[model samples]
Target chain A: MQFSGDILIEDEFLRDGLQNEERIFTLAEKLEFLAALEAAGLRRIQVGSFVHPKWVPQMADTDALCEAMPRNEGVTYTALVLNGAGLDRALAVGLGHLSISISASETHSRKNTNRSVDEGRAAITPVIERALSEGVTVRAGIQSALGCGFEGRIDPARVIAIAREFAALGVQEINIADTAGLANPVQVFDLCRKLQDAIGPDVALSLHLHDTRGLGLANMLAGLQAGVRIFDAAMGGLGGCPFVPEATGNVATEDLAFACEEMGLATGIDWQKLRAPVARAEALLGRALPARQSHVPSPPWLREVA
Target chain B: MQFSGDILIEDEFLRDGLQNEERIFTLAEKLEFLAALEAAGLRRIQVGSFVHPKWVPQMADTDALCEAMPRNEGVTYTALVLNGAGLDRALAVGLGHLSISISASETHSRKNTNRSVDEGRAAITPVIERALSEGVTVRAGIQSALGCGFEGRIDPARVIAIAREFAALGVQEINIADTAGLANPVQVFDLCRKLQDAIGPDVALSLHLHDTRGLGLANMLAGLQAGVRIFDAAMGGLGGCPFVPEATGNVATEDLAFACEEMGLATGIDWQKLRAPVARAEALLGRALPARQSHVPSPPWLREVA
Candidate 1:
């Protein structure tokens, strides 16, 4: 219940945020966002994903975007890579950090990757091994680790098994994703505690939460109580699982960062500066995003009286 | 951290929800919502507020709506009354429960009711006494109890003093409202715990939270952790403080109930059934509401497989 300590927030705006939008963002627009995000003091950012253009048209220019990204000291840029081809693309672009993920739910795994959970695990293991062997920092993720749209109530033991597998593969971090956002605070706390116990402390555990059910921040609180320090958030709360029914955005970066700052946790994020990217995204999308802090000005209490 | 036991959720859709909305709903429409809420197993419902029509045009027909409301068994219907005139109106309407509230912040008090904090307190003291004399169930509330948008941070001592004043007057409940939605979970927990210690167990403390910065549910969780059981929510998350800029809806009734049920707490609310009223509200308002559960279909995990 006591939240004290520093937390690392990984902004996935350019990747997860833009992947689901119908209109594909040009390279220039993405670079503009990247610059804004970097300028906002986000130390960790997911630039984009190495996915097939046929699968995710919005992410077709991930390689080009990565090649054009400016290398900044003290900033870690990551990208999601699903398969061997995606890994090859990431290596070709000389990306240092790569996220390799598979769904914990069999139904979700097949639907998302066109492979069963076992096949998906088998496929990602080699990619993870290859990435780690090449000195690339790998973050292995278990998608739908909490629950699934097609498959109900994913077992915690299964998620723990995947986390253990990822840990044994020598990944730097393991992420438990509430891909469908079917997670409550109690479940999040219990599952995160169990995962922490299962994986031990050497491997860092991160949470990728969605706000589909409005429990995203509450769940994040639970994760914090359970000893998680890394979280994935998107600017303007953009991003959703296309395969999941009625899936909304990830927990908004500004909102999450604001909560962290309010809780006395050091996130090294200038949450106020995040409004620029969110505003730009809103303009490009031609609609107001769901991020609450982005739309509402900070209350007087949060500001310094001159 | 442990949230167990039964909780009381007072649905304020008819009162708080409609107050800030631009279009005024007809009495028949309100009655329909009342019936829907009742049928959805909501035992406590705030029908509307007895206020000047010039101030809140949406609640003009509160007395008529109260008159037409069916007297269901075991149901507690309440109305918000701001002053002597509003109390007289409630008495004339033969209402059994009334909420007399004042802002804890001086600036908010003056802006909201045209009275300073002390003046607002003095003005409401006689109304609370009169209502108690009439054997009316009274809920004395401190608006902006946690933080104020205009005045910034409200001192916790002020809120406790007001609660003590109300308790001394034999009020049935003390409600703490985050009118500006600026409360963080840590502050909410610490303050609620302090208030509980100050007030003792005889009087119940309920939380009235807004989702302005997307922290409503998280703050609710903190309240639960602090051992305060009663809460106020609105159908489809309808409601915002007009005095507070960019204030969004109250915590969604369905979302709050869903979180409770998922956490193994009994709320006596048929959350799925309440979607009917939410759909109707959205239709009438001509916009999607902020409630997450209402917009998204319950995932397969929540539904029983036939």
Candidate 2:
């Protein structure tokens, strides 16, 4: 039960959340969401990805979003950069934070980024070096670290090796992602222990989880018990894996915040304030989002106790 | 990290799953679901309730369902009985297992059953006596033991007192329910430990949880860590509290089972076989159900690793 006193939750609704969404958001709508997230007290936010527009039209407005988003002194705004071109685009927009990722599973690596795992690993050094030269905070993510849709079970050795590579590059953080959302708590606990051991204490560790198997929050709990303090979550459980149509996106931001708050951990995000953007997203999507707090009406009693 | 080696998951899909559905299912469909649950290797199931048909038209054909359900020697089928009259009906139908429950919160007691908490407590003794006299296995449940919709937070001491009462009546099992789904892992862990200590080990403890707050599976993990083995879940996450239309019903059986299997816990239920019933329920309800495994395709890799 011994865990961190404070947990940092990075809102990835605009990046991982909206990446695969069919409905594209305009620059204004994206800015609105950014404002809302900032207002809700989230310190770190992943605005969008710098992938090709043809592949992921949902995030085509990354440059515009980055340029127009309000700059707060304390808030750290990051963008997902897949390769050198993505890093170039992020640099052009004066973005200070960049997250670069490669899948741990070979099949998923090729399918997602059109590169083999080895190629993906080799490509990271220059990108990290370029971004770091520009004084940008870099986060290296290992996707499908637990399992994969196309490749099935991913080896933990691959994930640990990737963590070592990221550590050698002196990245600020290493993100272990359950890309296919197929991880269990025991796997999370065990793998996190290994990764923490391999990566050493100098680099921070974060987890990016998908709720595909309904284990998102449970995995978060496991990660916390295993000494991980940073997590990635979506606003309204938006962004399902396109590979698995039935899979939910990242864990809902409000839901994770509520769970952490109830566990006596400090997240510093107001769970109640998250409802507005979630409601707006549901209305825009014209469907109910899978976030638990979105459906629950705020009763009068909650004000006193919650 | 110490938990039970095996968990007993009781499928309450028929009673709690369908109670709040706008659609009314025929007796034959209910039988189909029942057979599917049996085929899936669930040892315990809650088939229906004996509440007044006028109050809950969805389960109007409980009598006929009880009379015609397939009898499996290996499976234990049970039913919910709210009052003496319902118990009389269960006895008349020759049902061997019955569950009787009362709310721990006074406001919820008055709202749901039209009785004060004390009155509800007073009523259980005679009902338990009658069921035991008839050689029936009676399970006593305390609803709102974690929280209540009407009253918000409920005292754990009230739950302990009720467990003591059920123990005095020599009931076979006691169920502590999060009727409003307001429970967090810390609360679940603390309260479960208290309940187990107060109720002792001879009387088996079960949990009836609503996924209203999206902590269904997380709370299940907590309960497992706290030494609770038996849980109540509905197929496809059916049955929200009738009063709270937005609140989800019990945790989805397939989702819970999948998570348990991944964690190396023996539930003994064939997780793959649950798809048919869940799909059928969705078709009957004419909407997508929230069972995670129902949507995930069975990959060949799952056979080797999962």
Candidate 3:
């Protein structure tokens, strides 16, 4: 009863999990996985990215995956687009939910997207405009929003500025990404509070996190106390960036669900359906992932384990 | 600047880490590991438990470990005990710092120590007397203190009764343990606040946590905000209760230290130096021990890789 609110979970297993693979899934495999997500009641999913396949062959079937994903009345399917060009492709597919990312650290923005923070800002402007005109939802993700492995420390003001810019550009949501998992709870609480005060809830906030330094959930908890309701997670903790060395995986969906339920926060997720996705993911990856789902006898574990 | 006070790190790698082992470490290895902990600037450690070896064979050598541990000027070494017999062994070894535990739930207490809640209470009285007479620093650990895996939920009043008991015993400290990892942050903060209000800080409070569900550090952060300090952690994410099947490891010491340091809290521990003990543990286990150390750098791969 202490946590009196509902939390939303969005799955990124397909898009993020693909990054850690050696071979791209065939169209059939991608469709099978997408269908599995739908059957499992994984409502909102970032199914794939619209970047060039030459650079990220792992997401080669972005277009096909988008077209093949089963639709549900209550579900929202999303795709990641780092720039205007990718947004164009996503728009062509009639995407209503879109995510655009720019690392808060100037160095990461340049290396990952070949743009400085300012240039990244300029690039995302058109995408935000298109989304508003097309009546689509845009969420600007400040990558490496918490800490920069390469930089040692990240300026929280830089992230706040980026959130402010996206808010001005009509972005409906803001995601603070711990791209390298360098954030602790205090930093998370402080930074989330700053973003919350700046945006005043005009832009809904979510966190796309990594378990790199193992404070992923701690950071999320801090964000939750700051009024964050949406979270991005992967099943079986499967997902990491192939381009980024040492990128482990996204915070596991099952683990986050467990924490929320125990806190009396409602996530509207049936964790039993998630286990099959985890098993399927491990089979696809040909190995177990980093973080395992908790073995507690919560509703999900009861259904899955028993 | 917002976070007040020094960050204290108490390593339980020797005591708790040994719980999850398929094959326990040799006494020589434990001694070597203790030396490594001191070298890492760890000023306090829960070295071993004085419980009956029949219950936890991994800790049968508690006496040998205490006798062999290299004593230091500022370092404080503590041992976990159950009753007078264990206290006698600790006193014989000249250990001033000691921990006694009883599960908050009657069911778990019965299974954990083969004694009912009231029965467990009756047994520890003589143990407390001996420790107080010897001028020992005593910490009464109340386990399953938050929520239980066996029992559905725990009442805060039960915990209050235990705290009142410890206070009456003239014990110096109380450690609230989420033995089954059932706590969420809100529950943690509320419970700690209630416990502190019921029993003033006559007994300095600490937390011993298990990450069975990945909310270990989150719960600890909540306790800190509630004005509770002192905690226990094992190295390399190793821990479990032999009696509690499939219980996960304790919060990893290196990971906890890194989290506190990142939060700008001072935990008087050199995480970089803490690596040696973990390495020894991994080598002996012949499998990678899951922890945050060497897992991933902060964020912004752009800088670290550059």
lDDT tens readout by residue for model 2, B164-258? 98988899899988877888878888888888898889899998887777788888888888888999988787877665444477888888888
State how far residue A31 of model 3 sits from its true place (Å): 3.1
Query: Model 1: iRMSD?
Result: 1.3
Better of 1 and 3 by lDDT: 1
Per-candidate local distance difference test: 0.90, 0.85, 0.79
Q: Which scores better on TM-score, 1 or 2?
A: 1
Model 1: docking quality category: medium
The residue-level lDDT of candidate 2 at B182 comes to 84
**Count of clashes, each model:** 0, 1, 6
- DockQ for model 2 equals 0.51
Candidate 2: residue pairs that collide: B239-B249
Reference-based TM-score of each model: 0.97, 0.95, 0.94
Superposition error at A204 for model 1 (Å): 0.8
For candidate 3, lDDT tens digit of each residue in A172-268? 8999988777777777778888898888767798888888777778888887877788999987777777655666778988888878877888878
Clash tally for model 2: 1
Decreasing DockQ order of the candidates: 1, 3, 2
